[model samples]
Target: MPSTLRSSRDRPFLPKIKKSFTYHSTTNRGLTGMKSKGKMQGKALFYWSILLPALIVMLWLTLYPMITVFLTSFQNYNYISGRRSWIGLGNYKNILADQVFLTSFKNTIVYCFSTTFLEVLLGTVLALVFYGNFRGKSVFTILLILPMMLSTMVVSSVWKTLFHYDIGLLNTILSRIGLVRVGWLIDPHIALWSIVLVDVWQWTPFAFIVMQAGLLSIPQEVFEASVVDGASYQQRLLRITLPILKDQILLLCLLRTIDTFKVFAKVFALTGGGPGNATETTSLFVYREAFQYFNLGRSSAASMITLAAVVLMSIFYLRKMLNSKEA
Candidate 1:
């Protein structure tokens, strides 16, 4: 009877001990989870701290100026006079009606497209021709890329001398060949093309280097397999090469289009947007309006238009590139 009474007493204490153990385990698990979450939060805060300064700087430099220009574009502002009046698209209308702006827009479009096409075409051709290793290849490549290494101002100055009507190297060569001297920069009909030629000379090598790098990245086994499948040179180029190079070509076009559209240094140093505004580009037009005439409103309006066009082109190319990458 005594032993039975003792056993019942121990059973009651055993349940209490079991409940206490369960409570401690639950508390421990909760604490561990909370510590892990806190650690993750701390890491996140640390990363954000590292990135915040650069992000703020970028916004200040790029976004602030863009916003200021956008606001100025809608106002009739003059820097010298310190006057600003909200005209709400009056600046846009005035610039659009200006014949000089229209001509500049046309010239910019022409220059952008022509230079991009020619540079890409010539670069691809050169890359193809120089694909294989050969003697003096390095020397030749170094020589070809030398022009691109020079500053634009320097290149333009050199070309300006060469484009001179009299005692110019180019005209001298024409005379030696029994051909008449052509006015490269003085004639309105040929001045723009003369600038185009200078651009092609300086930038074609950049395109060549980009294309050659792309070509080199492609696996040789792919070409070897195509050859085994009875693919001729033209067949391989058309079916395989061009398709692979589509993205590179698109990127090249985007870069060249942006650079050529804002052609100022070459035009300024070579022809000074002269020969009757034949080579005047939008960049030069904005510069003249903003600095020369102190017409900040019109300059801002022109800048906005150029920005829109560049943004559209960039978006189109970027989307195509991203889609191609995904594919």
Candidate 2:
């Protein structure tokens, strides 16, 4: 009992020390909030720095060109002669009156619709066939995707040779089968279809891949439940599978439609819009007017028209897709 009092260091949990610590907790929280604000500001700066350059590039590459084309479409401009004059809607009128433009537009529509339909049908069927595991599935899938993997120009060149009217493999087989030696790329009636065939061969694989991805995403448990509930294979496919794949099919058609609508290289390589322009397309029409003839005004007008049509079609499909997504 000599010295009963304890030092503050040994009694740190005393009321006075506890009150002192509680008074400083607000300061600690204030420091933490300041640090968090500084970090958030730094992150915002970093993100803006990355996004600013991309936005500038997009303006230069896309926005500027689109604006220039829209303005030039109303002017009579000759690229080679460097002559430009305001012509109002003269270029559009002239193009609309041209039979060549009419034919090209018609051919584009036909190609877009026909190829999209066939590709969708074939892709859906093939995806279903290859949905389940099978023997040699890897090899078959690799072979199937090869056509889409190859360069478009190379594919066009190879198909051009194979579709030659004389001494081509296709013609040789047709002759062997006692079929007439048909003109694949030369006949006006069949030239467009020939290009379609080449496109189908090259791009059907893309559609097939898309459809297969959609098919494979379906849960196996869902299918098993359907089977256990007394659903037949066909019933499950129609009632369950097809309904789930509607969006994929629609998206595939949209992509194919856009690609086929702008067809140029195939027609240029295979037919050169020959046989009186059977395979002529809107893209080809625009290209020849701009480069070959140096008619920038008409070219711009034709391009604008084509763009408007594409925009309308895209709007329709995109609305459908968005609606489907919302549903």
Candidate 3:
């Protein structure tokens, strides 16, 4: 009877050991699962922590303003009277038909193209001339770059004085040469060109510097090899130099085009978009509508139009670049 009791107790002890082992195994599996899930959560939290602030700031600063401007373009909103009303496409239609806006847009196109082309051409020539260093080259270069280095406002002020119809230095010089005093800024026909002259004088240095750097970057061996192959100077220039500097020229054109398209300071300070509307650009027109007349709706529409023009120009430049790359 005592031996039977001992066997039963031993059987119950084995079952208890098996139950404890199974409980420990299940606990370990659950802990491993929690650890893996925690690691994934931590990684996701780290990335979101970095990206969230920038995303929020961009939404506030850039996206919000763009959306506001887009919506406002279609509304007749006056900041002064605190009056707002939906205008549909009326603002766009009015600006498109407005004579002042049309003139300003035309002037901007003429000024941008003329100044960019002439400045790039002149800069390329000057860069080529200075390619072979000689006496006084450094001094000459400093003098040449002085115009662009000066502040635009200061340049405009001085040029404004110089362009005075009667007592200006240019008119005085013309009188000395026994010629009629020409109206540099007064005449409607010549006012836009006068702005172009100021822009070219101030920006040609930038183009020159770029072209010079491009010329310097060309390998000397290539030129020497062309010479050894008996290529003429003009042939070498056409075949080797201009091809290499094409990208620099195009880059300068792109920058100058955009800057000139948005020209306001020179027109405001020198010509006041005037004598008539000769030197007016889209920027001045937009400024007048938004600030002077308090026509926010039309102003926004003109702004969008200007933006579209700039975008189209950028697209054109990008397409040209892509074509060059593919070639």
Candidate 4:
């Protein structure tokens, strides 16, 4: 009778001990989870601290200037006289009406398209021809890329000498061949094309390098299989190679189009938007308006127009590229 009574009393104490143990474990788990969450938050804060400086600098350099330019575009601001007046799209209206702006826009388009087409075409051809290993291939490649390494000013100086109508080497060679000495930079019709030639000569190597990299990335097994199946070079190129390189070609066009659209240095150096505005690109127009004329308002408006065009072109190419990738 005493033993049965003791057992009943022990069962009540056992339940209390079990409840205490469970409560302690749950408390520990909650504490541990909170510590882990705090650590994660600390890490996030540290990473953000590291990134903040760069973010600020980028915003200051790019975003601030862009905002300033956008605001100034709507105002008739003169840098020299410190004059400020809100004109509200008056600058854009005047620029559109200006014949000089129209001519510059047209020239920019012509130069952009012609140079991009020729460069991409020539670069692809060079890449195709030099695809395989050959004797002194490295040496030839280095030599070929030398023109691209030269400064624009240096290239302009050399070409300027060669473009001299009377004493130019090109004219001398032409005379020897019983051909007329063409005015490369003198004639208004030929001046723009001459600048295009200079641009193509210098930048074609960039496209060549890009295309070559793309070609090399393609699997050798694919080509080997094509060859084993008795596929001709043309068949392989059209059916297999071109399809694979479509993205790279589009990328090349995008890059070249953007660069060529903003052509200024060579035009400024070689012809100074002349022989009578023949090579007056939008970049030069913006520069002259901003600095030479001190018409910041008009310059900013022109810049905005150029920026819009570039954005549109970029979007078009990017869409095409994305679609190709998805396909």
Candidate 5:
């Protein structure tokens, strides 16, 4: 009878052990699945945390203002009244008809193209002249880049004094040299060119710096190889150097063109858009519209137009870069 009681107790304990083992195995499987899921979720959140802030700031600063300006361009907005009404293309039509605006546009294009072309040409020449080191090379380079180092507003102020019709340094020097003094800034016919000259003086250093960097990056062996093949200076420049530096040239052109298109402080301080309207640019026009006349809607439209021009120019530059990459 005692042996039968022991067997019954043993049987019950065996079933209990098996049940506990199965329960513990299930618990372990559940914990492993939870850990794996948590790790995947943590990795996803980490990447998002890294990218989210930049996206938010870009949207706030760039995207939001762009949308506002685009909407404002189509409205009739008065700064004084704070009134806005849809005006369709009225601002564009009005600006196109305005003679001052048209003159400003023409001046802007001429300034951008002429300055960019001449600067690049002069910069390339300067780079070539300074490519090989000599005594005082560093000093010469510093002097060359001095004009670019000065603030544009400060440079404008200095040039404004220099360009005075009679008492200016330029006229004084000309008089001393037995040449008749010429009007550098007073005459409407020559005011635009005078401004262009000042721009070139201030910005040529920038172009020189860029070109010098491009020149320095070229492999010395390539030039030696070309020379060994009996290539002339012009031939080596044309075939090897220029091709390698094409992208740099294009980039410089794009930057200078954009900057020249927005010329204002020099025009404002030096000529105030001219002895006539010769030195006015699109940026000056927009400034006058927005600040002088308080024509908010019209200025917005002009801003959009300027933005469009820049975008188009950027597309052209990007296409050139892409083509170079493919080649």
Candidate 6:
């Protein structure tokens, strides 16, 4: 009450600070943005680290060789002299003009188509025969498939001897049966067909195996239902089995076509591309060009052409498969 004004010590003491304190919210946002950017950058770096090695390896192994072949195909490279000169399109032109190439091309198509058709047909029949349970079925299957298990070269050698004109088992059997002995391999007209027979014997079992797998995948319920509907065996097989196995059939066709197109070892072992180029294949021609004549450019061009054909064939099958899937 002595005075309305009080001393500073008597009232609440407040100190005056001199240091300036700035609250910058924008700085905090900037730090957060930097952290986010750092996290994003780290993740991107990790993905690149994982993928770079695989890409590098693929480039080195596959891409490098493909590039080399592509470049070499433009050059008339002599392997001994190592002399390289550009001869663009000359190899392709020569191959297209060569009568040997044309003949071999025809032979290849005929052989591939014939073998594929026969094998698939016979395979379907064999699959049907063995689909049901019977006595000694396992033994029969093993025995049937043993030919496919044998190497192509071995099978060819055995068949070469069997098809020998002079003293073959086949001729001997024909002689024993009082039938005229026929020349199997020596006859140019029949030599290619003889090779086809050997191929069919060896590969029919493969087709059978594939078809059987397709058959086994089918549900028994569908067959039971078909039976309830009084469908005949032929009707059920045609309507149900074949429809469901379409993909498998197409796949087998693709595989067999590709395999038979590249037929070489058998031809080499048996006919060596002919008694007259009657059984010559594109692969054998490529081999001769690449190795025997050292015409790398021509061989590469032929290989590319063959590859293009195969790729086209594969595309057709794949398109069918995709359409079936959609349906």
For residues 266-313, what per-residue lDDT tens digits would candidate 5 score against the true structure?
889888887678788899988988889888888888889888888888
For residues 133-227, what per-residue lDDT tens digits would candidate 1 score against the true structure? 77777788888999999999999989988989997899999999999999999998899999999999999999998887777767679999999
Instruction: Flag regions of model 4 displaced more than 4 Å.
Output: 1-35, 317-327
Estimate every model's Cα lDDT from 0 to 1. 0.86, 0.83, 0.83, 0.86, 0.81, 0.81
Candidate 1 has an lDDT of 0.86
Clashing pairs in 3: none
Least accurate stretch of 10 residues (summed lDDT) in model 2? 1-10
Task: Looking at model 4, report the run of 10 residues with the lowest lDDT sum.
Answer: 1-10
Sorted by TM-score, highest first, which candidate order results? 1, 4, 2, 5, 3, 6
- lDDT of candidate model 5 versus the reference: 0.81
TM value for model 3: 0.81
Give model 2 RMSD, 1 decimal: 16.7
Give the least accurate 10-residue stretch of model 1, judged by summed lDDT.
Answer: 13-22
Clashing pairs in 5: none
TM-score of 1: 0.85
In terms of TM-score, which candidate is stronger, 1 or 5?
A: 1
Given candidate 5, what's the lDDT at residue 122?
97
C-alpha positional error of residue 264 in candidate 6 after TM-score superposition, expressed in Å: 1.5
Provide the lDDT at 117 for model 6: 96
Put down candidate 4 lDDT per residue, 1-327, tens digits, no spaces: 223323433344223322442344444345455658777677668778999999999999999999999999999999999999999999999999999999999999999999999999999999899886777777777888899999999999999999989999999999999999999998999999999999999999998877776677676799999999999999999999888888678778888998888888899999999888887989999999999999999999999999899888888866654554444
Off by over 4 Å in 3: 1-61, 317-327
Clashes of each: 0, 0, 0, 0, 0, 0
* Model 5 ranges off by over 4 Å: 1-44, 50-53, 320-327
Q: Tell me which of candidates 3 and 5 scores higher on TM-score.
A: 5
Q: Residue-wise lDDT of candidate 2 within 1-327, one digit each (tens)?
A: 101111222432223322432345444345356668777677668778999999999999999998899999999999988999999999999999999999999999999999999999999999888776767776788889999989878989998889888979999999999999989989999988888888899999998877876776666788999989999989998999999877668778888998889888878888888889788899999999998999999999999999899999999776654554444
1-327 in candidate 6: lDDT tens per residue? 112112222432111111113334554445355668777677668778999999999999999887787777777877767788999988778888988888888888999999999999999889988785667776777788899999999999999899988889999999999999887887888888998999999999999877876676566799999999999999998999888877678778888998999899999999998788877889999899889988888887777777777888788866655554454
